[model samples]
Target: MSDPTPVFDDLRDESDELDRLVAELSPGQWALPTPAPNWTVAHQIAHLAWTDHSALLAVTDADAFRGLVEKALAAAETFVDEGAETGARLPSAELLARWRQGRAELDRALRASRPGARFPWYGPPMSAASMATGRIMETWAHGQDVADTLGVVRAPTDRLKHVVRIGVRARDFAFGAHGLPAPAEEFRVEILGPSGDTWTYGPEDAPQRVTGPALDFCLLVTQRAHRADLAVRAEGPDADRWLDIAQAFAGPPGGGRSPKGDAE
Candidate 1:
C-alpha cells in the first residue's frame, strides 16, 4: 500500500469542509437532532473535537494521554457520550473555535511525528498515517449526521478511497473484535470508485468476494448506514460474515444504523 500522507492531507481537507458547513449554522440549527440517538449537531461536532484533541495528546504527550485513556476506560460505557455532553455545553462560538484549534493542532502533531512511529490510542497504537485516516473517516461519518439532520446531500468523492482501503485492511480486526476467527481464505473486495475506476483488494482467485459502489462500502464500514440500504454483494461464507460486521474504525463493535424505512 502507498504511504498515506497524501491521504492524510485529504483528511484534513475533509475536516475543513465540515468546519465550513457548521461555521454557518445558527444556534437553533446547532440544536437540531442528528441521526445518532439523543445527539444533536452540537453533540456530533463536540465528539469530533474531543477526539481530535485526544489524538493530539496521543501524539504530543503520551503519558498525559494514557492517564486520560485510563479515566475513559473506567467509565467505558458512557465515556464517549459524556465527553460529547461536556463539549456541547459550551457556547457555539467556543465550541467551534475549540474544534478548529483541536483539528489544526492534531494535523500538525501528526505531521511532526517520526516516520513509522506509532501513537497510543483507546485500542491499539496507530501510525501517523493510520491515525490521519481514522480522523478522516470519523470527520466524514459525523459530518453525515450533520448533513442528514439538515437534509443536505453530500456529493460522493474519490476521497472515499481512503475509507474503502481502511475497511478492507481491517477485515481481520472486524472478525477478531467479535470473537470470531478470520477465515483462512483471503477475501476479494472490488468496488467502483467515484472516478469510475475499479479499486480492488485481495487475490483475484480468492473464493470470497465483495463488490459494490465505493460510497456504499464506505458507509457500511463506517456504520453510517445499514448493509440493507447498500448495494454491496458478497460471495462465500467468509465474505458474508465480513460484510455483516465490518467496521473501519477502532473501538468496540458499534450498533450500526437502522435499515431504510425503519424508525430510528
Candidate 2:
C-alpha cells in the first residue's frame, strides 16, 4: 500500500492533538457527559487508553494479545463497558497519564513492526498501515464526542481523508457483516473535502454513486450521527443500501445513533 510512515505520523499527530485538548479540561469538564450514550469525556479517553494498550500488546506480543482477545470475546457484551468504566474511575491526572503513555507506546510498537506484518484485531488481521489508520479514525471519532460535549466546533482537516478512505473501503465489509451479499457493481463516492477539493473514490463511471461533504460522510460512516442529519445522497439501489448500513469500524453490526431530536 502507500507509505505507512506518513499515516503513522498522522496518527501520532491526532493523538497529540487530543492529549492537548483534554489536558486543558477541568475535573468537572472531564466528567461532562458526551454524545455517546452513558459515556463522559473521561469515559471516552479511558476507552481510547484501554484500546491503545490492547493494540500495543497486539503488535508486541501476539500470543498474549490473542489470549486477551479470546477472553474479551468470551465476555464480548460487557468487555468494552467494563474496561471503560474501570479506567474511567482513575483519578483525572492518572487517567490522562495512562492514556498518554498507552498512545505513545502503541505508536512506537506499530512503527517497529515489519512493513507487511499483520496484527490480530477484533475483526480480521490488520497490517501496520491499516492499524495506524484505524487508530487515527478512532481518535478522531472519539475526539468528536469530546468536542461536542464542550460545544467546540472543530475545523475540518485533510487528516479526515483517512477516515473517508476507510469508509469507502468498508462498503463491502459493511454489507457482509450484516450477512448480506455485496453488490456486483462498483460504487462511486464524491466528497467535497474541507479544503474545497473533490475527494473521489471508485470508478468515475460507476452506476452507483454517493455524494456529499467529506465531514458528513465521515460522520455517517463512523456512526457519530444519523444519516438523516447529514447531507449525503446516494444514487442507485446498491449505493442507497450501502449508506443505510455503512460502518468504517469492524464489529458486530451496530445500532447507529438515532436521528436528530430523537429521545435516547
Candidate 3:
C-alpha cells in the first residue's frame, strides 16, 4: 500500500496556499462575491471550515459523524448552503480562526488514525489518503472561485494531481449521479500537467478517449468553469457525455458556471 503521508503533506500545502489568499483580506473584501452564485469569499472559506469540521468528526467520532450525515440526508439540498451561511455570518477573524483550528484538528486526526482504517463520507467510506485528496480538490475548486472574484490568477502546481486523480476516479460516480449507467469499457484520459508532463489513465488503446490540459480537466470536473470554455476534448460518445456531467466532488450534479463572456 502507498504511504498516505505525502498526500497529507500535499493537503496541508494546498490549504496553506488558499489561506495566503484570504489571510489578509479586509471585512469588505470578505463580503466580495465569488463565482459561485450567492457565495461570497467568506462563504467559500466558511464552507471549507464546515467541511473540515465534518471531516474531523468523521475521523474522531463516528456517532457524531453519523448525526451529521442524518442532518444532511434530511435536508439534502439546503444543508450545504445552510452550513456555509451559518459560518459565513461569523465575524471575519472568528471565521478565519475557526477554519484554521478545524482543519488543523482534522489533519492531526487523519495522521493519527490506525493503518487501513476507513471513515464514512457523504458518498462512501474513505481512507485518510482519499479524505485528503477530496479536501484538496475542494480547496482548489473553491480557491478558484475566490481567485476569480479577486481577479487573481493563481499559479498552477503539481498539487493538482490529487484533483485530477479524484476527477478521473469519479467518472463513474458522475454518470451514476445523473441516473446513467457507467460505460463498461474504460476510457483513456490524457492530460498535460502544469509542468508539461502528460498524465495518462486507462488503457492506451481504449476506443474512448479524453485529452486536455490538466488545469482544464480539473476545472471541468470541479464544475468551476463551463465546459464550453475549456479545452478538454472527448473522442467517443461516452467520453463526450462524461465531460458534460463530470464532477469530482460528491453530491447531486451542480448547476455549473456560465460560459466565459456570457452574462450571469
Candidate 4:
C-alpha cells in the first residue's frame, strides 16, 4: 500500500476542508440538496461524521467493538432503506454535530494506533492503516458532493490517494454490485494525481489508463460524477461500463448516475 502517513494526511486535509465549509454555512444553506438525491448538505456531513465516529469507537474501545460495528451497519441500512421522509424528518444539525465530534475522536485514535492494528470493517479483517485510508477517501468523496452542490470547487490535493486506492481496488466490485459477473481478466488502473503521485493497479501494462486530473478520476470512480461529465476516460468496453456502475463507497448501490450538469 502507499505510505500510510500521506494517507492520513490526505484524509485529514479533506476532513478539514469539509469542516471549514460546513461550519460556515448559513442555516438555510444547510438544507440544500446535494448531488446525492434526497440528502441535504447537512445529511452528507452527518453521514461523514457518523462514519468517523464509528471508526474512532471501533479503534479506541475494544469492548464496544462488535456493537459499534453492528451499529455502523445498521445506520447504513437505515440510511439506505429510509426515503426522503426520513431525511427530511431527521435532525440535520444534530447529525452534523455528532459526526463532527466523531471525526475528532477518529483523528485521535488514528494517531495513537499502530499501522497494522486490526479493525472490524465491512469485510475481512483490515489493518488500521486501511481503515484510516478508507475514512479519508469516504470523507473527501462525500465532501466533493457537498462542494458540488454549493458550486464551490476545492483544489485537488495530494491527499486524494486515500480515495484513489479504493477506486482502483474496488473496480472488480462494480460488476457484482451491478449483478454482472466479475471480469475474467484483471484490469490495470493508472491515476495521474495532482501532486505528481502516479498510482497504478493490476499488472504493469494491463489495458486501462484512467488518464485525467486525479480529482476528476477519483470523483467519477467514487460514483460522485458521471464518466461523461468529467474528463476521465476508460479504455475497452468493460472498463467503460465499470465507470457506469463504479462505486467506491460501500452499502447498497446509490441510485443510478445523475444525468450530469444541472442534473447534478
Candidate 5:
C-alpha cells in the first residue's frame, strides 16, 4: 500500500490555502456569484464541506456511506446542489466552522485507515492515498471557482501533481462517462509543472500524445476552463477527443464552461 501521508499533507496545504482566501471575506462577498452557474462562493465551500462529510462516512462506516450513495442515486441531479444549498444557507461563520471541523475529522479518519484498505466512493473503491488525492483535486478545483469570483489570481503549485495524476488516471472513466470507447493503447502525457519540472505518464513514443503545462491540464480536466482557452495540445484523434470530453471528478459529465467571450 502506498503511504498516504504525502497526499494527506498536500490536501491540508490545499485546503488551508483556500481557507485563507475565504476566511476574511465579508458576508456579502461570500454571497458573490462564481463561474459555476447559480453557485456562489459560499456554495463552493459548502460543496467541499459536504463532500468531506461524505468521505468521512465512507472511511468510517460502510453502511452509512451506502445510505449516502442511495440518496445520491435517488436524486441524481439535485443531490449535490441540495447538499451545497443546505450548507450555504448557514451563517458564514457557522458554515466555515463546519467545513473546517468536517475536513479535519476526515483527515484523521483517512490517516487511521488500515493499510491497503479500500473504501467505496461514488465512482469506485478508493484507497487512502487515492481518496486524499481526490480530495486535493476537488479542493483545488472548487478553490479555483472561489478565487475567480474574488478576482484573485492564485499561482500554480507543485501540488497540482495530485490533480494531474487523477486527471490522467481517469482517462478511461472520462471516456466511459461520455459513452465513448476508450482507446486500446495508452497515450503519452507530458506536462510541464510550475517549477519547470516535467511530469510524464504512459510510454514514450506512443502514437497518441498530450502535452501541456500542468496547470492547464488540471484546469481542463476539472472543466474550470474551456479547451479553447488552454494551451494543452493533443496528437491523434483519440487523444484529441479525450481533451474535448475530459473530466477529473466523478458522476455524470459536467456542463463545461463555454469558450471565453462566448458566454459574454
Candidate 6:
C-alpha cells in the first residue's frame, strides 16, 4: 500500500524494549563484561543512556550538539591513545540509575516533539521518528553484546525487521562511502528472530539470500562478532560482500575486521 510509516510506532516499540531489558536485569548482572572489549554491561548501557542525552541536545541546539560530539570524541581518542581499555569506572547502582534517567529523558523529548521537528545525529539530519528508530537499533546491537557476554539469549522480535531494513539500506552507503561499486542487484535478507519472527529485505526475486538468526545478523552488522562466530549464510557474492561490511547505524565506517567465515 502506502510507504511504511516509520514513526511513533517504531519509536515506542524500541523504547519499550530497551526500558524493559534494563529494568529486568539483576544488579550484579549489570556489570558483566559484554562483547565490547573491557566494556562491562554497565558501560554498554551507560553509553546508550548517554547517547540519548546527546541526541536531545542535538534536537535542541545543532551547533552545540556537534561540539558535544567533537569534544567527547577528542577525549575518547585521548583515552584510547593512552590505553585501548581506558574508561571511566562507575558505581553499579549509580550507573544503572543514570541509564534509567537518560532513557526517560529521551523518551520524554521524543514524545513532546512536533511533527517535522529535526535533530542532528551521527549521520544525516533525523526527524523524531528516525531518532527513536536509531536508538532502537543501538539498543538491540548492544543488547546482543550483553546477552553474548552472559551466555544468556535474547529472543527475536518483529521489531528486528526495522534494524535489518536499516542495515540493508546502509549496505550501499557503506560501499559508496568506501569508493566501491554500488550493488545494482537486490538481495534477500532473512533473520529468524528468537521470537520466530523472520524479516526479509531487498527485492523478492534477487539472486542472493542472507539468512540467519536475528541475534547473529545484528552481531555481524554491528561488528561485535565475526560472521563465522554466528550462524550466517549467503547464497551470492554480492550478498556476502554486503554482509561483510554492513554499517546499519550512522557515522564513520567502523573499520572493524570481519570474522573468518564471513566475507572470506
For candidate 5, write residues 122-233 as lDDT tens digits: 9879998999999999999999999999899999999999999999999999999999998999999999999999999999989999999999999999999999999999
Query: Poorest 10 consecutive residues of model 5 by lDDT?
Result: 1-10
| TM-scores vs. true structure, each candidate | 0.95, 0.95, 0.98, 0.85, 0.98, 0.78
**Candidates arranged by lDDT, highest first:** 5, 3, 1, 2, 4, 6
For 32-131, candidate 3 gives per-residue lDDT tens digits of 9998889999999999999999999989999999999999999988999999999999999999999999999999998999989999998789999999
Q: Output the number of the lDDT-best candidate.
A: 5
Q: Lowest summed-lDDT stretch of 10 residues in model 1? A: 1-10
Q: Write the per-residue lDDT of candidate 4 for residues 112-228, one digit (tens) a residue.
A: 787667877656666777887888787787788888889998888777766777877787677777789877777777778887877777776877545567787787768777677
- Alpha-carbon local distance difference test for all models: 0.91, 0.90, 0.94, 0.72, 0.96, 0.70
Query: Cα deviation of 112 in candidate 2 (Å)?
Result: 2.0
**1-264: candidate 1 lDDT, tens digit per residue:** 466679678988999888888999999999999989999999999999999989999999999999989999899889999999999989999999999989889888887889889999987899999889888888988998898899888888888888898899888999998999998888889999989999999899988999999989999999999999999999998899899999998778999998987965
Better of 5 and 6 by lDDT: 5
In model 6, the Cα lDDT at residue 186 comes to 71
Worst 10 residues of 6 by lDDT: 79-88
Residue 110 C-alpha lDDT in model 1: 82
Clashing pairs in 5: none
